[model samples]
Target: MTTRRNFLKGVGASGIAFCSCGMLDAARAQGAAPRSTPVMVKGKRIKTVDVHAHCLFHESLNLLGTEEAAKVLPPTKGVPEHFIVIEQRLKEMDAMGIDMEILSINPFWYNRERDLAAQIVKVNNEKLAELCAANPSRFGAFASLTLQVPDLAVQQLEDAVKKQGLRGAAIGASVMGQDFSDPKFHPVWAKAEELGAVLFIHPQSTPQLAQRFKGNGWLSNTIGNPLDTTIALQHLIFEGTLDRFPKLKVIAAHGGGFLPSYAARGDHACFVSPQNCNAEIQLKKKPSEYLNQLYFDAMVFTPEGLRHLAAQVGASQLMLGTDHPIPWEQHPVDHVFATDTLSDEQMAAILGGNAARLFGLKEV
Candidate 1:
């Protein structure tokens, strides 16, 4: 009974709140944001790793061939490709109590032709690695890959982890309009599992929903971004992509978008309306079970918001995240600390231990 008009009509006040609530929360957090580092849990200092931080190298942007159009700065929030000032970054990290940050450049070259995409990948991955090297104690990075070409993406992932010393690769929710659940991208997933590289999934705004996302609260990002991530994750789960590569290490941004918020619905969809669910692709585990193997960031805006997310995904699956330089999360450390339900040990892990174990990072 879901019609195009009905779906369009659904984007009403709730859609506006979907984007506005986070801003409201951010405004509240600004007054309480931390001013120094050395975050402690149980009276002991612990390192904090922000796995969901983003960046874009200016050199990589040069390949696009126009000064103004080169850097893809969204009107809502952005970390400029040209301005990753090390001193300023460290100062910000100190305030956030982040001991180390694993940086990544969200994929902006997926639409480029193969050759240009490869060049962009080369520049981005190499520059990120160089940054980590220069600030070994304070920085780590996820590499960039040309996922539009799976064979090349495999090589890029291998070289990035083995040679350039990147922890993993950051990817967009989809390539152009192609779903990653399609077998075409299987090689990249297989290679990532083979190399033990983490595949960080970041969502670009859902351009298809642009018509409905207009006017206000930066709905393109608030609603579109999370919706983009939600669709990508559901496809991977229901389409058997997670079953196909069970060992593949994956992480989802923005608290796995809206999926975790309503994951129980995934378990019920096939039974309630088998007609809409795919019959050809059978998932090995219950739809909700796939989430157990996946990772998520603590980008939700409030302590209760985070506490509820942890209840759904388990505290072990959650790690610190700040869509930094973009003002999305002003007090990521304090946000985690404020989760009253979490024990001291769980707090330590969420602060940084979980990320260190996943990325093999040493405590600072």
Candidate 2:
């Protein structure tokens, strides 16, 4: 039996860069990792879809001109990736037992001026659409947009989904420190709901907690990332953004961050301190109940973790996610299968059924 140690060994040996974290510790593919164990449920082979894969555009890399490319780009910037992306990415997906990946580029352009950010968004959205177009069966993408300019973002979201054949939009937990609950983003949310597009929330970690997070253990990501998503989701609930756009489909990465782990506290917040929550914005549902409306990737790292998440949120809301190339949850399909608490149908849904339905992916 291949232990989790062996699974980590394969990814660590051949893992690509962590491009979004502003650092990169990438290595070339260390030969081919073994192909993944096939997922069989009820004597049928189930398709596995990885919904949290990432990538960046080479054309847009040079466009972050305010800083030197070395600092602006990931550590492995000019070294790998751009040279052999498709071939390499497909192989990794295959080894991870992923039949298709829903690609997204994190919001590095979130802080740029409107015009420059627009330029970067164009490059990324176009490239992502093109790549997915070329690899129809293996890839689909969530478009990048300039959220700082919500008007432009709405139009961009419309274009990406309607014209480009993209699945949805990828956004940061917050834009330049501005939370999504702010009314300024309502137009984008409205457009997303109208178009039936999913908004993927990927965290850049919490800049506000940088001081406390400075020591060992990559705390910025370990604690900060999940915290950021928790904060983002709370804001959306507390401020009634989710209520306003009730149909908005959201996928929160890293297992919807720390929200699922400690959600009953949210349900009790208003009861404990009515003064802390805004009186003008009344929530339609309990904060924890809103979790049922949201979707999450299974990157929680344990069968119990996934099991707990499925218990908190419905099993119907769970989807497989590998956070590919980052080496997080490399054996994703196996991970779902390992969760003994889930029935065969529940495991099938998390492995791929949920994502394939959400993204409108046709079957083999």
Best by TM-score: 1
- For all predictions, the C-alpha RMSD in Å is 9.6, 5.6
Reference-based lDDT, each prediction: 0.81, 0.80
TM-score per candidate, in order? 0.89, 0.88
lDDT (Cα) of model 1: 0.81
Please write out the lDDT profile of model 2 over residues 66-132, one tens digit for every residue: 4644564444323354332787777666656788889888788888899989999998888888898
TM-score of 2: 0.88
lDDT of 1 by residue, 190-309 (tens): 999899999899999898888999997888889888998999999999999998899888899999999998999889999999999879978888998888889999999988898898
C-alpha lDDT (0 to 100) for residue 237 of candidate 2: 86
Lowest-scoring 10 consecutive residues by lDDT in candidate 1?
13-22
